[model samples]
Target chain A: MSDTLDAALRLMRAQAALVRRFDARLGGLHGVSLADFTLLLRLAQAPGGRMRRVDLAEALGLTASGVTRALAPLERIGLVSREPDARDARVAYASLTGTGRERLPEMLATAEETADELFAAPAWGERDVPVLAGLLTRLGGTGLRS
Target chain B: MSDTLDAALRLMRAQAALVRRFDARLGGLHGVSLADFTLLLRLAQAPGGRMRRVDLAEALGLTASGVTRALAPLERIGLVSREPDARDARVAYASLTGTGRERLPEMLATAEETADELFAAPAWGERDVPVLAGLLTRLGGTGLRS
Candidate 1:
């Protein structure tokens, strides 16, 4: 493999491992999957803690149907609510409820803890974080916007 | 979010974007998804170009049933075959066929090109490649063993 391909393979493998770790940790601690946490994080940062379904789909890299399916559980648990857009009846927004805001801090804490453990591994030191983050942000597009 | 969590989130987003891009390119050019490419890569590197079903599942971070479901199409296309283990009738290995070997180079080329485009972005200088790879290897256990 070319050097570039070699690096790409390493990146992909690292992602798979980290994702598995994050998913497990987040799910066990917060009762939320990484995907769900991502959605909630995005919602938490949105204006008024609400977003249009289509916008959420785009931001979360989920399809419209995928956004709907993922939101079902959160909505059922009162963490999110479907609110009809007043001016456009056909358009509905997903609004973060008080419960979701309440749950987010704990979930965010778990995410931070997971990060600390993973990055604190002997293989990585303090200096490496920014380099990794910069490369990922460039590759990921939209930077840290999500 | 803490700096660590912010980095982690960026990494996750990058993985999602790259995976989507790779899946689209691989599927379009080779009639294989990124997950399928990963499986084939693992099989090709395994001893005798084969691996047990359970091993495949673990390496791919997929469940046993997920591996089975993913393999059915490859088996149908004659790119992969199920081989019974002589010592254990209950054990079966997934092996790459000659045709699969013939097809691998082209698919690999596509992956390389995808990596080139992604890494060539101005955000990643030549020096950043090794740093990124090293950090990812540390973060992603087993490194680039796949």
Candidate 2:
């Protein structure tokens, strides 16, 4: 039981390290951090490639203030734009801009490569990739605004 | 494929968030971050709760300087001690103190609870846990170093 528990810890750690490395490398290549990449990815999920700032924070499990700190750099870089919502003047909407849309393809490609490398681990068949991915996603608890 | 890819990324992000939460909570309880807890765990693996600093770095997938930085706080707390290796003046050794030994069980119990809470992902089982753990340990690229 203890041994298995150790394995779960290791699995989590290995995955975290890989993400950090990929984030640092790919992020450095394009002058963004992993946190920046994540924000962009979140924006990409919206209908017009954007989300409300508070929504993005909840999605990422980050405090609204931390989201603001991360967004400042992205906004400064022109990757994100915050404007008063047309329907709700008090709410600010964070939307991707021309710069963010343009840079995403490159980031996505780099992400794929990193995933490819990690998937090369033994017994990790190509098919098993989706299986594990499914388990993780359901476990991730995304879109739980309720 | 895109859906699955998103899932993989989500799994990775969720795992990172969970660990960070655990580290924060555990740090409050033990005055040690997860990284510090790991160093203590590694020290306990040595013949008599002692190992060379370089080896510790290698075992933890950390650069020597990173290990040095982590050691500073532990040494200050007297939970661990560092000394020049008796046989090799150039080598530094890290050893656990009586306080450290006494504290290990408490930390381990906290760790077990944290793991149980964080990695309670679907489809996980005791049988699959070791296989994943051993695979992740190897994935860390430290197999040859240890």
Candidate 3:
């Protein structure tokens, strides 16, 4: 394999490892997966703690139907709610519930703590984090501002 | 969010984007997704072009059940076959068929081309590829030697 192809495979494997780790930690402690945490976090960062379903799908790299399927469980758990746009009945929005807002900080803290440990100590140095983030941004990754 | 957390999110998003791109290209041309390609590639790399089901699961970061499910379609399509251990009835192995070996090169070429284009533009410098691979290695990603 070429170096670029190797790098691509490495990225995929690393991501799988990262998600497994986060899912174990976040799921065990917070009753949420990394995906759910991301959804709630995006809502928290949005202008009104809400987003149009299509926009949220784009942000999360999911199809509209995928977003709907993902939100179904959260909605059932009262972490998110659906709001119909008054002027455009065809438009629907997904907004974080008060429960979601209240619970996000704890989830964010757990995510941060897990992330910190992953980059800490013998494996990674101070400079590696930013370097990796820069490369990932080239691939259209977000969350740099946050 | 801390830079560490941001980096984590970026990794996830970037991986998703990469998968989407690879899926589109590989699926369009080869009728196989990246996961299928990886499975076949790994088998080709093995000493006998085969591996125990459990070992395949570990290498792919999937469960035994997941590996079985993934292999089902490939097996049905004649890209792979299941071999039962002659002495140990309990052991099962997944081996690439002649068809899989013949078609894998084209699929690999497509993956390489997609990966090359992703890192080729104004976004990435020559040093970026090695640098990113090194960082990902710290996270337990492999494929560096290949």
Candidate 4:
């Protein structure tokens, strides 16, 4: 905890807050919560339009139970269709239906605009963007390098 | 969506995963959970080891309710003390406790390593961190900018 450390915290705090805002605005614009929007997009883009529950859970950084809970809204909207896996009855396959595929493009577009806006905080100059990203990347190294 | 839009989604997905990983690893390395850990550090570095709940909420990008909930654990652990604002009874003040002040340095050291490790994603080289920070700051500009 020196002055440099204090300065780093400000940058890290900004980095974390920006990511959360990206989700909020993106979700608000799309009329779909960020978490739900991601689920829809993931299912729509997956091969065969389906993914195993466990794999989907991993992709989402959620526990299996968290995914089940999150799926309720998607299922209610008919955007998601979950079924017993053909190869493994114990596994459930979650896929995007026609409605989800149709809605995804619109949501995706709004989301990107939100992302672009979030990426450009005025307080920090344009040059600050990539510099902070690089510094954060270095600070967060997994200890495999110098 | 066009190819470029899809690329944005790809970036969102990758960054979201990295943030979650960063949070998880930070919590694991130290006994402090991510939310509590961030709270303590912010409080310690604030003007007087205290700040308005709304300001903290804004800084943390958490909704009011989310901030309230996050404060509960900290308060319970005696790391944070909550008091009704004399100027505005409806508002609450969250101040770091003496214990919290003493513990801040150690917690931050843990964060330094975690932040460094996670920011070191191969995708963001040393030179790219500040640029990403700037972009993320801009990204927070539109909407609630929460």
Candidate 5:
């Protein structure tokens, strides 16, 4: 394989491994999967603490059905609430509940810890994280949120 | 969030987006999911083109059940076969079939093309790939194979 392709495969595999680790850690500690945490994080950042389901799907790179599936557990736990858009009844939005906002910091902390552990290896220097993040952001284009 | 944590999240989200794209394209063009392609790639690289199910699980960062589930379709399609170990009756190994070997190049080619398209953006220069791959390798440890 070409060097570029080889590098891409490595990146993909590494990310997969890291995600599995994060999911296990986050789920065991906080009862939230990585996907759930991501959804909550996005909702926490949205204006008025709410986002249309379609936009959530787009932002998360998930299909409409996927977004619905990911939201079900959160809704069940009262972490999120579904509301019809005031301007358009056909449109639904997912809003973060007070409990969800309260719980978000702990999840973010866990995610941050997981990230620190992954990058704590001696092989990764101080500058690597930012450099890598920039490349990933460029490669991902608008798919990755700030 | 701290810079390291932010970088990690970006990497995770970017990889997720890329994998989804790969799965869609590979599934549409070659009838193989990205996970399946990874499995086949691992088997192809194993000695004698075979590996224990447990090892496959470890290598893929999947549970034993997850490995079993992923293998079912590949086995049904004659891409893999189960063999009882001579020394351990309880252990079964997954061996790649001739048909699987025949079909692997096409899947790999598709993956390569997908990688090319993703990195073709102006933001990624040729030098960036090795540097990014090196960082990912460090983060991933031995979990990521060549």
Candidate 6:
């Protein structure tokens, strides 16, 4: 494989391992997948703790229908709620519920702890995080943009 | 979020986008998902184009059952085959068939092309590839070991 392909494959594999770790911890402790945590985190970062469905899809690199499907479970669990736009009936929003807000800090703590452990000690260098973040941003992984 | 958590989240999102792109192309062109392509590529790289099922699972970051479930469709499609260990009947190996070997180059070309496009142009700097790959390796991405 070409260098680019080699790197892309590595990225995929590494991400898979990372997700499995995150899911195990997040699911066992918080009853949330990494995906759910990401959704809640994004909502928390948004103004009024809500975002338009289309915008959320764009930010997460998912389709509009995918965003809807992802939101359904969170909505059912009362961790998220839907709001219809008053003027434009076609427009809708996803908002983090009070329950979601209350629970998110704990989730964030777990995720952060998991991440710190993953990158700690002999495995990672001091300079690695910024460099990796910059590289990921090039692939449209703009993280936690307020 | 801490810098570590931010980078981790970015990695997750970037991988998701990359997988979707790879899946769309690999699936449309080769009738294979990225996961299937990764399995085939790994087998192709193995000595004699085969590996023990347990080892394959370890390399792919999947459970033993996941390897079996993933192999089922490929085995049905003739891209992969099962080999009984002659001495140890309890152990099984996965081998890339002749058809698989023949077809892999084309699949690889498609993957390489897709990856190239993703990393091309103003978005990607020349130094980005090596830096990113090194970072991914720290997360146990290891790339193509053979």
**Model 2 vs truth, CA RMSD:** 3.5
Candidate 6 lDDT tens digits, B20-69: 78999999999999999999999999999999999999888888899999
List, residue by residue over B1-146, the lDDT tens digit for candidate 3.
99999999999998888888898999999899999999999999998899999889888878889999999999999999999999999989999999998999999999999999989968888899999998998886432221
TM-score of candidate 6 on Cα atoms, chains taken together? 0.90
| lDDT string, candidate 1, A1-146, tens digits | 77777777777777777778888988898788888998999999999999999899889877889999999999998889999998999788999999999999999989989889888857677778887887777788652232
lDDT of 3 at A41: 94
Best candidate according to TM-score: 3
In angstroms, give how far residue B105 of model 1 lies from its true place. 1.0
What is candidate 2's lDDT per residue for A1-146, written digit by digit as tens? 36644755676666656666676667768887666777788788778997888888888877788888989988998999987888988688889999899998788777666667666646466566655555454345554231
**Residue-wise C-alpha lDDT for candidate 6, range A73-140, written one tens digit per residue:** 99999999999998999989999999999999999999999999989978788988988998888885
TM-score of chain B of each: 0.91, 0.81, 0.94, 0.79, 0.92, 0.94
Q: Which digits, one per residue and each the tens of the lDDT, describe model 4 over residues B2-106? A: 332343344444444455554676566655676678777777768988988888887766677888999998889888999778888888889999888887677
C-alpha TM-score for every candidate:
0.92, 0.84, 0.94, 0.73, 0.90, 0.90
Q: What is the lDDT of residue A44 in candidate 4?
A: 74
Which CAPRI level is candidate 1?
Answer: medium
Please tell me which model should have the higher DockQ, number 3 or number 6: 3
Tens-place lDDT digits, model 1, residues B49-144: 899999998787777899999999999999999999999998999999999999998998998898888888566687877777777877776522
Interface RMSD per candidate: 3.6, 4.5, 4.8, 6.6, 3.6, 4.4
Rank ordering of all candidates by DockQ, starting from the highest: 1, 3, 6, 5, 2, 4
Alpha-carbon shift of residue B120 in model 6 (angstroms): 2.2
lDDT against true structure, model 1: 0.85
DockQ for each model: 0.60, 0.36, 0.58, 0.25, 0.51, 0.54
Native-to-model Cα distance after best TM-score fit, residue A60 in candidate 2, in Å: 1.5
TM-score of 4: 0.73
lDDT tens digits, residues A42-140, model 3? 999998899999899888877889899999999999999999998999889999999999999999999999999889878888888998898898886
Q: What TM value does the first chain of each candidate achieve?
A: 0.91, 0.84, 0.94, 0.72, 0.93, 0.93
Off by over 4 Å in 1: A143-146, B143-146
Pairs with steric clashes in candidate 5: none
